[model samples]
Target: MKSFDVAIIGSGPAGASAAFELSKSGISTVIIEKETLPRYKTCGGGFVFRGRKNMPFDIASVVEKEFHSIDTYFSKKHPHLTTTRDQPIITMVMRDAFDNLIVEKAKENGVTLLQNHKVENITFGDTQILHTTEGDIEAKFIIAADGALSPIAKIAGWKETRTIIPALEYEIEVPKADFERLSQNVRFDIDAIPYGYGWCFPKKNHLSVGVGVFTKTNKKINLKEHYATYLQTLGITEILSEAAHGFVIPVTPRTDIFVQKNVFLTGDAAGLADPLVAEGISNAILSGVQAAQAIIESNLDSEKAAALYTAKLEETILPEIRIGAKLSYHFYHQSTFRNIVLKKYGQFVAEAMTDLFMGERTYPADYKASVTRKIKEAIF
Candidate 1:
């Protein structure tokens, strides 16, 4: 059995970020990953500027494409609108490369990364013991950054409270002409599905085209049909590959509990994905850092660390998630109200969203007041 100060499960953005922070603080940290390094991860691969701003190191080498503006389409009938920023709005990178980069940085900071080790069972007692496929590990603290369907979280008896949504993505290699044209801009069609959106994000060599749906609503939407329609609308006639990747995304944060004794849940394992846009990487990294910070600040006191983590989440992440959930409910479920607001204040909303992505602003800080004002104005 190996003993460590912290045992982090999963080596995605969340795990790697936590390991990086812990190791940098001179904590004995070990990352247990189920897969080999640089394995392909299913994602749209669009990293928003908000995430980019928080990273401690530069990712310029891994960035495949950088977009200065986004083209948003409300529907096929309505003309698409463009939002521009002086700096790049989003940077596209393959998850394999991006995740590998972060893990390597953690390694540089003396983090022990054990690849191909899957956590099989976790036993709690005087000290937490993680039984993995390779062997067993003893750690003072456990950070479950495993993912949306986190086995560690389940083993800890944490009931899931977030909504899980289904998503599909295709990495299509188009012709040189089409690739060049599409690579110049990032596009999102909000009306591609009933309660979802379609995106075309260009990589250095391929385009990541995908469709996602918020399944909490009663709307019945065929994701496959919508994906095909989206490709057709984009004039992507030829797909070099036929294989499509499917995955589940957590769209809401878990409200029940994030910390239990010595065990702390971060990233998708904690259901920290944004309800409005379904983005997880930013919150993943944020939660990872906060988890490590809690342990460091509490001097490895598990009970105190757990309390601090919950307080931090309540002060920062949960508030934004709550507001986002409210906005998502209105924006997706109430279609008539959404259309009216967009039709009248489309530009203002677009700019505000762009600012939010850029970290220049946040979601309704006073959600109730803001919503009340909007409702009154709408009715008037």
Candidate 2:
């Protein structure tokens, strides 16, 4: 059995960020990954400024593309709104490269990394013991940075409520001549794709386009059929290489109790994903950093660590998730309301959500004080 101060399961942005912070704090941290470095994660590969702000190191060298313009389209209203900012508000990068870069940085900072090790079972008592395929390992504390369907969370008997948003993403190779048109805007459309929206994010030589919808009342709409139909309508038939993938995005927030004795949970494992846009990259990274800080600040006190971690989340991320959940409900439930708002202040809406993603603004309170106030005033 091996011993460490912290053992992190999963090597996504959340796990990597936690390990990085732990390494900087001079804690004996180890990151165990079930897959090899640069392993492919099924993601849209979009990075909002929220995660970028929390990064302690420079990521300029690894940034694939920095976007300043966000184009939003409401299919029902037939309105298109474009929001532009002075600086890079959102970024696009390959998840494999981006996640690997952070983990590699953590490794450089003296964090031990174990690859191809899958954590099978975790027991929490005097000291948390992790049973992995590699072997048994003990740690003073455990951070379940594992993903939405985290096995560790299940083993620890953590209750996570999930509202799965089904998404189908495809990376298609586009020709050089057509690259400019596709790369110009990161497009998001509502109404045209029922229950959810279609997004086109530009990559180096390919385009990542996908449609996602809430899975509350399971509809038999075929994602691939819609994706194909949309692409054909857009006249993007050029094909070089393609990879089709599907994944679930959790819209629910964390349960009331996120900490159990010596174990901590964050990221999708704890259901910290935003409800509106289904964005989790930044949320996951932020959760990981907060979880690590809570652990260190508690002085190895599990109760304090859990409380602080939950507090930080409520203070920072929960508000956004709450607003997002409300927005998600509105967007899916009431198309008339969605179209009215989009037609009125589509650009403002995009920028405000972008602001949250960029860490410039937070949730619920901000919404109550701003839009809700404006809406109330306008109504009266």
Candidate 3:
């Protein structure tokens, strides 16, 4: 049995980030990846400024493009909103390179990388044993940093309580002329889909276009049909090549425990994707760091690690997600009332959101109350 102080499942941003932090502290950290490094990960590839700003090291090498501003479109009800900043608001990256960079950085700090090891099951005890395709790994702590549909979480006996929503993304190569025009800005088209939106994130060689609806319903939603409509809305005429990928976003955190039997859950496994924008990378990195810190701070005590990790999340990530969820509900579901507010303060709202993405501002605790106050003030 291969033994380590801590073992992290999945080498996504969350897992790589945890390894990076743990290795810095000289913890015997090992990252178990089902595939080799630099493997493709399905994401829109928009790395927001907030995530970039908190990065322990520079990632300029993997950045494809950086936009100083973002454009948001709400057809007919309001004018388009463009928000700019002195710094890049969103940075584009191909996930394979981006995720590999972080893993490489972690390795530099002495973390072990167990490639091609798919975790099949885990045996819980004083030292948890991870049963993988390659071999069994024994570790004092386990961090489940896997994606939304975490096999690790399922094997760990977690029941599904997260509000998951479906998303479709396409890597499309369009005509040079169209790419030039669309690549000029990062854009979001609100109401392009029912109860959700469409986004266009341009990369170095292609465009990552997708449409996702936030609210879940019994009525069937055809996201492929919406993607076609969104392409027309974006003035995309011809697609020279295209690759389609479908995934789910867990917008709400699990209502159950985050830590059980010395195992800690982070990232999409814990359902920490931003409710408003469905941005997972930043929070994934954040939660992974927190989980590592908890183990380090607890001096490898399992009970203390769990408590500390929970405390850190409640203090930082969870509250923000809770508020963002509320805002998303109003922004997407209550279109009539939301449109009225947007018509009046559309630019202001967009700027605030841009600032949030840029790490210039945070979601206020009394967000709903503040918005209500603003609506009343405007009406009165």
Candidate 2 differs from the real structure by a C-alpha RMSD in angstroms, to one decimal, of 2.2
Provide TM-scores for the models: 0.96, 0.93, 0.98
- Candidate 1 vs. true structure, TM-score: 0.96
Q: Model 3: residues >4 Å from true position, as ranges? A: none
User: Which residue pairs show backbone clashes in model 1?
Assistant: none
The order by descending lDDT is 3, 1, 2
The candidate maximizing TM-score is: 3
Off by over 4 Å in 1: 366-380
lDDT of 1 by residue, 26-87 (tens): 99999999999999998888888999988999999899999999988887555677899998
Ten residues in a row with the worst lDDT in model 1? 367-376
Q: List the residue pairs that clash in candidate 3.
A: none
Top-down TM-score ranking: 3, 1, 2
| lDDT tens per residue, model 3, 167-222 | 99999999999999999999999999988899999999999999998765566789
RMSD of 3: 1.0
Q: How close is each model in CA RMSD to the real structure? A: 1.6, 2.2, 1.0
Model 3 has an lDDT value of: 0.92
Report the lDDT of model 1 for residue 252: 86
Instruction: Show where candidate 2 strays beyond 4 Å.
Output: 364-380
